[model samples]
Target chain A: MNLSGETKLFLGVIIGTIAIIVLAAVIMSKPTPPAPAYTRNQLIPIGANTKGNASASAFLVEFSDFQCPSCKAFSSVVESLTEKYKDKLFFAYRHFPLDQHPFSRTAAAAAEAAGKQGKFFEAGTYFFANQTNFSDEFFAKAASVLALDATLYEKDRNSNDTKKKIDDDRFFSDTARLPGTPTFFLNGKQLILYDSSELVKAVDEAVK
Target chain B: MKEKFLNDQMTNRILFILSLLGVAIALYVTQSFLRKTPIVCLNSGCELVRKNPASYIAGIPVPAFGLIGYTLLVLLTFLRTTSTKLHKTLLPWIAGITGGGVLFVSWFTYTEAFVIGGFCTWCVISAGNMITMFSLSLYSHSHKK
Candidate 1:
């Protein structure tokens, strides 16, 4: 076949497209590398509600809302995962109350209030269990059920400090441009969970 | 006969360019859908479509199909330009490919309008591109003889 200038040019573009696509596929398919240490705490800042050893090399931070169905679904798994890696994992839960979930903000505040009383995770048990049943007085009932100080729970849950903490989590969520609820970061790398079991596998890997 | 050859060359060039444009549009849509990023569209239609389950088929983002189709067209158009023999062989394949593309895009457009109850600007632009390429395919087919 006799070669033409335009033909070569178009073929060049076609070849270029294929080359770029192959390069991209190769890059995207490789496992994500660990994030640098300095940027690690940017998402898991000080005073954030946390469990496990602060200095542990494996850190897991979750941006979640109590009223989110997916978050609730993953709550039990995370709880058990944390228990399994209690010594090795440093876990933090940030609140990202989507506007669609009307009670999520209040539930976040309630969780923080329980944090103040040192029963945040315990309160979480109730919150995740009764997501669909949240009412204005649900927080109070949960506090009562957990045997927390009723007066302090009411005062703290309604306090400006609790509001600020939840607001700060929201601010961080927006700053990170988090895609959706229950977004998890394991060892400073976001975990894309296709199934709940991925969490256990990832945490096991992280701790190891 | 020389004039006719030039016309076919011009038509193939036009098809190649259009296919290139389709690639760009499809690439953007595919990336946006995969990354869950909001797309540039009028009246938030892009976000609506992005969130809708219909934007995917069998868990594969819809724009991926467009990307493959357009990229294949790009290759075919360039091959047709190499020689008259190749053009004769490739022109009917181009027509068939674009004909299938038009049908698929039309179905997607209909799903967007009626089933999804919204429109993505990229999807609409892709539909237009597919239709135009199909029209060019028919034009070249008629002129082939």
Candidate 2:
């Protein structure tokens, strides 16, 4: 076939366009290793449930859902992260209850309620451990171990303030376009965790 | 063939370039979305638009449609520039395809702004790209020989 130079050039452009797009996509989509910890602790919102150092420049924030199994697995990692980095790193947890999990919203409220009584992480453990059995009954049993006043626990969990707090966190997740629960932000940078250990790596980098 | 197409091939050239740009932006958004990597937005809107149930139509990411639309526009514009015989025939196809592209952007932009309450900057760029290409095509179609 006798093709003009114009036709050949057009074909070249098309091929080049496709090739460039594919190349760029491959590069951008590569799972980013934990971003070098560039901590912006100010991004940690006021009133967020937090642990570890209050004034530390290095911090980690997580938006998690209690009924999520991956979140359950991750909570332990965060638990140890807080302990290991105590007096050095700050950690904050925010609710991002996905609708697919029936008990996610309730569990988030329960966590908030626990936060009021200085048992946020403890309540989180109970919810994550008893993920399958989430309900008022299970929460009441969990609250029993927290040594919280039963009446206050019940009242606090059901209070409007607790509901509003979860709603605010939910709104932030929606606004941030958080991909899903168990999403972590090291300092202010989002971590692309291909492995659970990335959290530790990220915190280590942040503190350094 | 119009003297305009022969002498002033500016729209054809520009449309091709704009459509190519659209392809790149749409490709990035589609892949970022598929990989579940958060797009860094000018504001927080990208996440809201991306993660919304509305972002997927029949399990297909919305930007995938933009990618297809832009790619088609690219091909048609390229064919028009290369083949004088096919030039007239390709103009209407370019216009029609871009018209559809505009409509697609309109729906998503509306949903993003009103329903989802946010919009991605890339989506905005794509919307402008389609609208500009469509306008240029309209000019090319109506410009007198």
Candidate 3:
């Protein structure tokens, strides 16, 4: 069967035309979605150890791991801001121990155990500031140092209360679709702070 | 028709098939974006690379670029007239660029799986497609007398 030259040329044009149409359709179909409505108070969450009104106009929630360096730095910023804003802001701390970090969850549970004695934030801040002290002895010693009720701390440390808190915090992390630790939620919306300046800007706006 | 058979009929058919699959995957991602579903990548490297905003150039996804490249290859394969030596010469160049892009994406995927801890399904599929296209292009073009 002798295939004519013209027939081959025709085939090329037809298939080429189809490919172009498909590519163009794909390119044109996806347009980036518009940015969500945002405000300052709706951007950063209040964390545990924070002393403030829950009914405050703005709330900040921090999802963090004790072993993370960035979480420690971010924690410091939050602490200063908390002091700066004192009465006007609300803060909450949620634990999100990433799978790669071995000691984060144990530290989180230990902190929750402290929470039962009204020292949750104190223990958590201590853990972040001194992450190298993640050994069982170190954590137990921190509990003793904070003067928590030893019996209750030990019970809650190994109890459902600790696991549930960790699990509950994980739920928010998943909801925010966080890719890494130190994820912050201002109000209930995901807060992406690319830099410290952005974070400060967010807090300033929230206070406004 | 010998020229047409060589450039369009045989080679173009495979390009068209591969390109269609690439387009289908691209469309699926678009739909996922529109529906606000998480861009799930079971491949660790794929997920890590995708998770990084730095992976995109000017907000355009790397896979989207792959989609355009595959589509262009398909067009070049099917639209080139057999008698034109220019189209014949261009085939390998198109395949080389496609192979290079795949190579870059593959390195990132490797880092994700071995170094990082996640996977991306679409990236793996696209890499496979590029490898297949490169093989086919070489096989078809080399056999031409």
Candidate 4:
């Protein structure tokens, strides 16, 4: 078939436009690793400090960082799940303070210190709620709001025990090869399903 | 003259079939995204790959782009098959468009394999369709007199 120069130029423009669009799409999308599957057999012992039913058959373990925006966003979902499941679920929160967040370790330390006073969950809730305003003063204010002993809280925050607790959780996170913060494991199995409804269904199945 | 006609007919038929296949795969993904339902996946990574922020461009699903591309290919193929003048005019352009789709699909496939660490079965099917269509279009354009 004979082709005109004008047609060739038009085709070239269409092809170039498509190429640019595809390239832009690819560039805009960030790559993320697939969530890993963890088995119940590999479940580590839940630490002394945790929230929800201690005797529940199903456990939801969250490896979270206070400064992570996704973790903050998921906090309310976790709270709703805890309320809905109540006695049926054991919720364990572990500290996995990422180094990228300048104040994450301090926040983790504050939460751990609050745990020493049986107010870890409360402190965690406060931190996640006020993630943008995290500071030494904020941690102090949270401790006071929880009615924790200010002196004891300060001492505990700087204690080796608190540091070890955070380190231990980090160790478990590393061993599990967690891809990022806000990762959840239900009864030791990673929740790879992204949808909340699907996750709820999975939880219901596990309960059975 | 007869041989050339036969070749054109075969090329058009292949392009039509492949375009249909591409459209089906893209439609499925688009629907899954819109409906907020789990996509049928032989591989476990489909959910992860789909949920990734990378799967969308400015909140628009990537598969929507695939749907548009495949739909265009179908229209182009139909035009090329029905009108001799249009066929000559559109054949090279079809090859170019298919080539671009192939490149895009290749990048998506690479992300699924290397970055996402999980493959979506439907996505793989769509990529396969794009590759086959690109090959057929390139061959037809080159063989054209």
Candidate 5:
């Protein structure tokens, strides 16, 4: 079974053509979206955060990292809503650091340090509010703003307890299927946070 | 010797196409695996391999490696059309490389299934591609007779 050089070249061309076509088709296919946000949510609570005010009737759990810009934006919206709907809504913040973000876990740890100073919510609020100013110097500056003891802030920031708290939060975030930051679970149901309006509508719905 | 060489050349062409088919299926499965991100469950353990840091090397997915490897194998088949002594030596080395790749991926699949506790559809497809390449190489090696 001998084939001429021309025949071999022809076969190669045909194979190449088929390969190119199949590869092109595969690459061109539209990608599927992530899990639908409107789906059910059996909200899993994180460490020491017992669904925050269980009696509040409406619960909103946020999967966020202090260094995340989107989380910062959503934090403001949540704050406004929480103030307006005070005592009617319960808000809980959980850490979910993007793997590539270098300073996210550090910011999370710093927040925990401030929490030890009885300023968990305050530290969380300020951390997201001042995310643009994150650094060693800025962390200390924020601590000063929060009136936390500098000595304890430094010691607690490096403490295993702080790390464990972040890790535990991570576990809950992971279980909740929180892909990236700023994911919200309202009333044990997943809410679409694509836009503030949608979020607000979802939140208002929960309260009703 | 001429007849023997021509026979080997044609056999390589067939083997090349077989490996290419394997590569194509592997690519399909790779895409399938990535589609189910944020893998919610470990029932199948596919998510473990999908999320594994080693799943991609230098940012290129593993299936991409197989795609390129098979394409090169296809090109090498065309090169063998004329019995050049240089290509005769190169073919076995190529075969060995393909075989070694199969072995490496097999171990990866094993680790994913047993150690990581997850089974990735794409990883399985890539493993299947390697097995086909290895088998085709064996067939080609025999065709040298």
Candidate 6:
């Protein structure tokens, strides 16, 4: 019953190749799932941090945390898209500070405070650009750089209004069942962010 | 004496084949992750399960780790089949690796079923391969010496 070593190696290769081919065929035969139906709802709120035309047909909402590295990475992309589609897209940012980041809430409040002075997008950009610096001094410096009223910025940063705005956004995110930071919603439908190109494609589809 | 030799060769052949299959599965999954392509699936749940943040560890995709594991197993199997001295030396390590792989498969299966509430067809197949490989490796080891 002894077999030559060459025979064993050849048999092993054959068996392995057949197994691989079968596996590939099985995977290829799988049916692709239909596109998921996203529920349309009113995700916008009054005084939300927004850019672009309010009446644009394509509405893009971002649920992001300032202290989240991924969120910071996505900020520039979001900004570029907003500018590119300024005439046809409306972009909004909502706070979703994760509990794991100790400075996330403070950053969210800082952005909201800047929003009070009609500089939400600018403040947000600053927070994302300097994510490693999250101290109060840094926030104040951002306000100064933006030429916001120093005294008003400090007061508004700690105001009940700023806290409420952030809290409300968190509540909405929870209700929508968002899994993580940097989640995007297009026209009230969630867009899975596997890649930035996916976001662009979704936006193009929405625009069409 | 010839029957025993033939059986051992057959066992090694089976192990090599299974290890190859494992590498193929790992490679396919890793490719999907790297390309950011949706995993092909007969079930609607593959997307849901794969999109979860838990699908990755410390920014590296879980399948990438799987690919490494399978590659190591393939190397070990190849060495075992080619050299008697290395075969004896690597047999225990192979057994431990396959055993760990089975346990990991079990944990991930439970996580996908209960925690994620979705399943990837590829993942399930890979887990099946791991279980078979574990069982066969144990059987071969037990019958050795």
Best by TM-score: 6
lDDT of each: 0.82, 0.79, 0.66, 0.75, 0.67, 0.77
Q: What DockQ was computed for model 1?
A: 0.15
The order of the candidates by lDDT, greatest first, is: 1, 2, 6, 4, 5, 3
lDDT of 2 at A197: 66
Q: Which ten residues in a row have the lowest lDDT in candidate 4 chain A?
A: A40-49
Better of 1 and 6 by lDDT: 1
The parts of candidate 5 lying over 4 Å away from their true place are: A1-53, B1-145
DockQ scores for all the models shown? Answer: 0.15, 0.09, 0.10, 0.04, 0.05, 0.07
TM-score of chain B of each: 0.93, 0.92, 0.71, 0.92, 0.64, 0.90
Please identify which of the two predictions, 2 or 4, would achieve the higher lDDT against the true structure: 2
Ranking 1 against 3 by DockQ, winner: 1
Candidate 1 residue-wise lDDT, B27-118, digit = tens = 87887778655566643456557666787899898999999999899989998878779988999898998999999999999998877666
Residue A92 of model 1, lDDT score:
88
Instruction: Summarize candidate 3's per-residue lDDT along B1-145 as a digit string, tens digits.
Output: 2443354356656676686777667655544433333454542233334444444557666566766776677556654544467457777776786677678668757755564334567877877887888777776676665
Candidate 2 Cα outliers beyond 4 Å, as residue runs: A25-208, B1-8
If chain B of candidate 4 is superposed on the true chain B, what is its TM-score?
0.92
Report how far off residue A47 is in candidate 6 (Å): 1.8
Candidate 4 runs further than 4 Å off: A1-48, B1-145
lDDT of 6 at A64: 91
Per-residue lDDT for A50 in model 6? 87
Model 3, chain B only, scores a TM-score of: 0.71
Candidate 3 residue runs with Cα over 4 Å from true position = A1-57, A63-90, A95-157, A167-184, A188-201, B1-14, B26-37, B43-53, B58-60, B80-90, B106-121
Per-residue lDDT tens digits of candidate 5, residues A46-113?
44433245568787877787776556656777878877766688777777886656778888888888
TM-score quality measure for candidate 5: 0.48
